[model samples]
Target: MTTATGPDLRERAETVLATLAGPGARLREDQWVAVQALVEGRRRALVVQRTGWGKSAVYFVATALLREAGAGPTVIVSPLLALMRNQIDAAERAGIRAATVNSANTGDWERTYTAVDAGEVDVLLVSPERLNNPDFRDRVLPRLTASAGMLVVDEAHCVSDWGHDFRPDYRRLRQLIAELPAGIPVLATTATANDRVVVDVTEQLGLGRHDSGDTLVLRGSLDRESLRLSAVRLATPAQRLGWLAEHLDALPGAGIVYTLTIAAAEEVAEFLRERGHPVASYTGKTDPAERLAAEGDLLANRVKALVATSALGMGFDKPDLGFVVHLGAPASPVAYYQQIGRAGRAVERAEVVLLPGREDRDIWAYFASLAFPPEPLVRQTLAVLGDEPLSTAAIETRVDLSRTRLEMLLKVLDSDGAARRVKGGWVTTGQEWVYDRERHQRIAEAREVEQQAMLDYIGTTECRMQFLRRQLDDPAPERCGRCDTCTTPAWSTDVDAGTAAAAQERITRPGIEVAPRKQWPSGMAELGVPVSGRIPAAELAAPGRVIGRLSDIGWGTRLRELVDGTDPDDAPVPKDVLDACVRVLAGWGWEERPVGVVGVGSRTRPHQLDHLARRIADIGRLPLLGTLAPTGPRPEEHANSAQRLAAVWSAFEPPAFGMPAGPVLLVDDVVDTGWTATVAARLLRHAGATAVLPFALAQKG
Candidate 1:
């Protein structure tokens, strides 16, 4: 194991801090220790500081130390554009040379390539998605790989699936780190993680010989002395609006009211505006220009209240905020904590109120259901896409469903890895699509097990926070002391029992009722040939064709002109035609399989059948399918860690004891379960390393 003499490292750290810290600046005790450890060149370190604890200062001190010691560049990998902007702004303000690369600024391929190759840039702040780009791997990472410096990952919790904000791209970071040069140190920092998340981060990062002792899990009292928390239960929307209006006048600073949906946000904002409150609304659907204007209004105190979706708070450091009101229940306690944490950032007293109603639970369940799709339908969709790109129109025709129904199925397929879209067409992306029959069956079975687990979580009778914490292997607190359950023990118990019993009844009840399918308009029958089990060609043709075809069948001249020389193939089908098809086919039970299609009436897994039925039902409800569009904003590109590592660490001090003689791995944190720690260790072993040790700023009991 590598070791550094304490006195020697402390001296170097002091020197570095003196150069970096401005006049009259002093390092906090924790920051001093963190800097000293980095000066020792431990190679793997985790820094678990509380929110607003100046965790970034540790890296700033380390960077100055490394640069003064004549080390190469260092890299910092951050997850959000807002975070990147914040760090870049701070670094520049301190007179440090720093650059930020994200989708917003680097709008095209050429700009991305140019920024990375520009050798003069010292520090780079980036998102995780950019690492997937081949250009970064080839043009930028090489310099960092060759440098002797440090690599820092901010918000390191994202690497674990158990994190509140999980992203798929984080899973690929281990492979990206493997390509870096030997003896490079890695530093990870996060404000949250309960034991398991810490271990997951270390294991996933592959830090060697770094023990849990190296981890520093800081403990802070949950009781925000400055924040006043309360919950107001309401029976109707009008009552809630009245409460909001009365409370708005009581709060003096900027306030944010979070709602369940974009529509609700607009309505609430409009209602407040009519009452003479300077209000603005922000949601995912708000146009960019309007969003910027709203943000400016809030920052300048021009707007007294801002009604928004949950997207407004991350990296927004507004200290003067007076209140944060949740118009609806947040999906999870973790989300609630993060959202409320936004207030009182300036150490000032703040108010947070949660307004809970029955509808909130349903909304949460609906979103949770979307996260896990039915495996059987997933498998079927994979088979259909089969590495081929097909438009929604073509997919609808092939699936023998209306455009609306097809679109819904496609959404489920995309989420479950059964399909992916490229250039507005779908393509298969799952292993089942390429596997042999037996293996494919095995994959389907495994998925069934996972699906059942997800359903169990959704239908649980226990405290929701407790259930989630257990899933992540973090020990549940005796009581959260803040969630709805803890706030009103009896009500929580009764609600849990009622919801559980209701879920059981819903599961055991008979299938949902379906309305009768509508008949095709007149003259549709003559448009095309009849295919067994398929909707007639007449049903697929436009109303005009149906009329003309009926006239051709001797209905009369009025119907003849309706069809008017149009080819049956070219006729437009009425929107309702597809809607009806979805309802009837989905309700009747339809399945897509490799051997042949099976109906819901066949003996398939119950959950699979339910999902298929739901997909069809959703499709039928859709107004139009052929012209569906991607809904969210374009995804942002990630950053290159190796390059950033080299730039930042080039100046870091070597370990006071010197680098280890053999191959060494490095990591940032560790927790009790060791899920992340084990994963990182295994990856290092696979990469031909001699030893893989885990390190962190703190360890949970």
Candidate 2:
């Protein structure tokens, strides 16, 4: 193998680019600069260029040159499986052997490691989470880090907590970079980071804070000439769906329709399918196999669009994707730019639209609530920590945090050196950890500022592309004489009344199954709940129904209003909500009909529950069984499953009438954790009820 000198580096790079992209493909000036910096200068560089700028070309060309020069394999810390797969294909096209070690390919790790050990592999792709993996970090990483030719951090914006899509796992890369030998070229690339995020990521990519001055920062104009940006304000979800039904096919080729929540993704996908559009739902909850199949379908143009959430947001590259539509605006323009970047990469033109919704803020609030908890909660978590390792579930029992929040906190603590994750679980290091209240507050405030900026973008009469670029602090901002405001509207805002009516009917038709909990949450005994394993069949509530999830686009809108605490606590159920409840009961395909109705006693919203139960009893011509009385005040909000069950275990007393003769309907206004219903149903069974059929107006998914 002949290593090209600095004089011929550009010539060699263009040759590799031609093979990787196409016969006539050539390197852009900035691309050549990045490649030279890595291959010749062996310097750290941060590239903040828009999509389709051929950032991969720079890295792959550098890898090719470095390998011929007898350097070790390039290690790329990519964020997603989709991105890794794409990079591998690109590497193979350039005749560079690339292998990935991610959760999806555990079975192939041994083979991959062996190939890396040999000189057979030129590049190794790894997910950021791999850096924190116990076995991989301890055994495989040291060898790779010590001998790595170049290090690449793709989607590098994730390293900054101030960034829109920050992940704690990505922060582990700082240590990895710190340990890398000097003169090992490092490249961090992202398309969506702002000025603040760029500085943060550059500092981390450098060897140390003072040495960050040496890192080359190349930022290009954040402009997509192929995208026609537009925002349509729809008064209702029905109108939005109606617009999609009418206009989805008129857009260029196939593309993605992004939603804010998993439920919304499923809901929109189902609606679009019913409207005769071939679409599939892709979300975090989607099975891994199904996700792969869906991705394949989109790539092959088998589906018109994929209704997805942020799970499909980053690193999904579909060149020539015709359009990118958002059912609800992302809270940050930076995040929105990253998602829509998937489109217009290889096409002459593509459509980018945002159908801003009133519920977007509420959805944003829900996600923000899961951010780092209050200081007292953190202290409570630390107080329970000992030298002995405690699993997340066990820690959850001691703290009043949800599983997601608890796991995130533990990861943060581990990164801060206050906690260590070993084979068993997490153990405290007894290192004094101060809560960075100012930093957290700044992050929270920045979120609010970004959210307001997004709203402003939707309502702005200025050029949409210009507004987005300015939000990202693009050095050069220019009005693209495209977009709805910059020029005449390319898309009609009119929603066909009949189509909207049909959409309303589809969305309004609601009944979501509430699967009963079978197994008791682990470590329940630690919370003073003796039960463990599966709950006995005698005490288990039958699979029930909720009118809708709080995150739903249709019935969820009304349900959210009913239980969002804005309404009077003593208010009765609305007439329309009652009608929806009746509709749900009419369609329930239960083998055994309920002979009576019993309401779960509520200190808050008692009138609502009582009125709903009595009305259902009257309509069904069944006896209204007595309501269970609350034995305590409402349990603390956001309690994990075990703590929630413990608090609600003795919180409800059996009805004064003792028990109903047959299967009884257990009613509540809303079910958050489902523990209240679980405990109440068990109490009714203990009181000699034949069965308990639980139901709720809305469920918080």
Best by lDDT: 2
C-alpha TM-scores of all predictions: 0.56, 0.97
Relative to the true structure, candidate 1 reaches a TM of 0.56
TM-score of 2: 0.97
Name the runs in model 2 displaced over 4 angstroms.
1-3, 205-212, 475-477
Query: Candidate 2, residues 309-368: lDDT per residue as tens digits?
Result: 989966677888999999999999999999998899889899999999998998999888
Best TM-score among the predictions, by candidate number: 2
**Residue-wise lDDT of candidate 1 within 278-355, one digit each (tens)?**
999998788867877787788788998789887675655566777888887666555565666667656556767776
Worst 10 residues of 1 by lDDT: 542-551
Clashes of each: 54, 0
Error of 1 at 62 (Å): 2.8
